[model samples]
Target: MERILLQLSYNGADFQGFQIQNEGRTVQYELERILKRMHKDFIRIHPSSRTDKGVHALMQYVHFDTTLSLPTNKWQHAFNSALPDDIYINEVTKINADFHSRYDCVGKAYRYKVYKAPHRDVLKRGIETHITETLDTRKMNEAAQYFIGTHDFTSFCSAKTEIENKERTMYKFEVIETDTGYEFFVIGSGFLYNMVRIMVHFLMDVGRGKRQGSEIPAIIAASDRTKAGKTAPAEGLYLEKIYLSPEELTQDIPKGTTITLKPTRRQLTQQS
Candidate 1:
């Protein structure tokens, strides 16, 4: 069997999350169903990350095995025909059988948009978190810089995580104001559950003067979830990109086959 990796994007507002569930519309379930229809057998897909419900993704990655004989470039067209309006395959390629989307990723970048205006736009309401509190963008930007470089992020993760190591590297972190809102971009080797959201929460609190900028180091040192701010809502979060090694990206393969994505909302509705 030939392994291929598919790169895609989706508007996650209507779905429960990225993972397959017994009863909910998910990205995995939709993709899996489509793949089974094509293969007439079970096809397993591995993704770089499982974004939370209401979260979106611009460059999500997944790998699956297929025996189709078409060229890699053509898989994009074939897959898009089966994808729903909310999701689309942007790119497709064959890769080494051992190349895994999750483990092979060097890093990931996520962006959280915050609408800081007095009133929210109808279109913007679902994509961004509306914050009326007057924020010092400069101060927030300055505080976010502290998050760069390697550090123990135990304090910033949600208490739900079972991972033992809270240590991760932050390659980049910045906050910039836009025409109607503020944007927070974070790039890291990896992230803990709710780590980015929690960090955004803390920074928002700092921007509003609810927390001191100088207190960040203390929060990191405390290694306690209670010391951090609330996990930001999932609507504002998006899996922006995944950085793959050159070897993983340049592999050759046969095509006519592609990975599938499951929509999250359908299963949830069925469950209810």
Candidate 2:
């Protein structure tokens, strides 16, 4: 058997989440079902991250072992032919047996889209969060700067989260304004359950003048969940990218494939 990695994207409005559940449809379940039909056996996949319900992904990663030896480029086409419309495989590559999609990831970036128009966009329903109130992106950016460092994120996580260690490093956090709304982007070493949503909620409070930008440090230091703002709805969140070491990702890469490593701040600015 050869280990294979797949890069894919999905719209999560209809699925329960990325993982399999006993009672609901999920991305993993659908992907595995298609694989089983194609390979004529049970096939399991390991995803890089577990996204909550209604959370979308632009560049999710997964790895699985398969006996079939289809050409790498053809693998994406073959998988997309059988997979549901909401989920699409973008690329496939062979990898070393030891390569892992989750553990090997060094960083991840997530984006939260907030629609601040007087009326909601009918086309964006179930995809973007609608807020009727105007949001101050400058204040939100100021508040977000406090999150850019290593700290215990207990206050920003869900109460139901079971992880004992809440410390994680935030490498980048920024709020950018668009014509109709705001975009909150966060890149971190790791994140606790609901951490990004809570952070966004806090930034919203700051933007609405309910909280001060300077108050963020104390709130983070408090480590009390009650001190944090409410969790933002999952529909607005998207897993934008996952970062892996160049060496780990280059193994057995397909010819003609161009991998773009994690972008620097300048690159992001240029793209913006």
Candidate 3:
């Protein structure tokens, strides 16, 4: 009955998305299959967030229950040995029973890379989106600052969202110019469906002079999906990290059996 938290990272080029689906392959489905093969039982891996198709994850958190007495290192070794090269489990730890990878997360960060050059590199085709339009990085960066703070981000979300709450806190949102492209990074306490992508789309539009940068505030005020820009391509987005405050990571003792032969305190500290 012990909970095992897995640090997951994947390319996300070939998979449909993070969740298990009936139509095509997915990260969760593959992980679940490996888990069933290893334990001979269905093990559910609860992901921190559900990324859209073609979206990548540099670091993703997932948790599952395991009854095996094997150590965390053994679990990691077993899982990695079975998983394909494209998908890797960076770390595994025995977390507090009450800790949830998704619900307990305090924030999520994502990065969208746009290649602005005319020539495209074949190597980066799957990782970065190519756009030849000349952009004003300064204006885009200025526009990004408007998104920082708590707001009703209904206008930036996808029309397909079924979630009730569109209110989310944008702690940090910035656009940085790179050697070959521009990177749009956003950190938020929560996000609605395709919120980051839509935000990026607006910024791109602003960079291209299609819309004034100040229109962002009006769009936020409007809270209408049509007021925002288009949703950016999924290939350019990556789930950078998920944060859980130290307080949230701590255990709240409950009426449950504790494992006796768990790793030492020092080893457990390294897990975080």
Number of the predicted model whose TM-score against the real structure is largest? 3
**Model 1, range 1-272, lDDT digits (tens) per residue?**
77778889998898889998777789988788888998889899899898888999999989888987667667787778988887888878777666677877766889998887667767875588988867888999889878876789989998889999888877667888888778889877789998999999899988898987788888899999999879888889988988765222222111321211222111101100
Which 10 residues in a row give candidate 2 its minimum summed lDDT?
Answer: 263-272
Global CA lDDT computed for model 3: 0.82
Measured against the true structure, the TM-scores of the candidates, in listed sequence, are 0.87, 0.89, 0.89
Q: Give the TM-score of candidate 2.
A: 0.89
**Across residues 103-195, which tens digit of lDDT does each residue of candidate 3 receive?**
767668899999987788788877999998778989998888898777889889988889987888776678888988899988777679999
User: What would the per-residue lDDT of candidate 2 be over residues 2-85, giving only the tens digit for each residue?
Assistant: 788898999999989999888788999988998898899999999989998999999999989999887787788888988889
- What value does the lDDT take at residue 82 in candidate 3? 88
Global lDDT of each model?
0.80, 0.84, 0.82
What are the clashing pairs of model 2?
none
lDDT of 1 at 48: 85
Model 3 compared with the native: what TM-score? 0.89
Clashes of 1: 21
Error of 1 at 211 (Å): 0.7
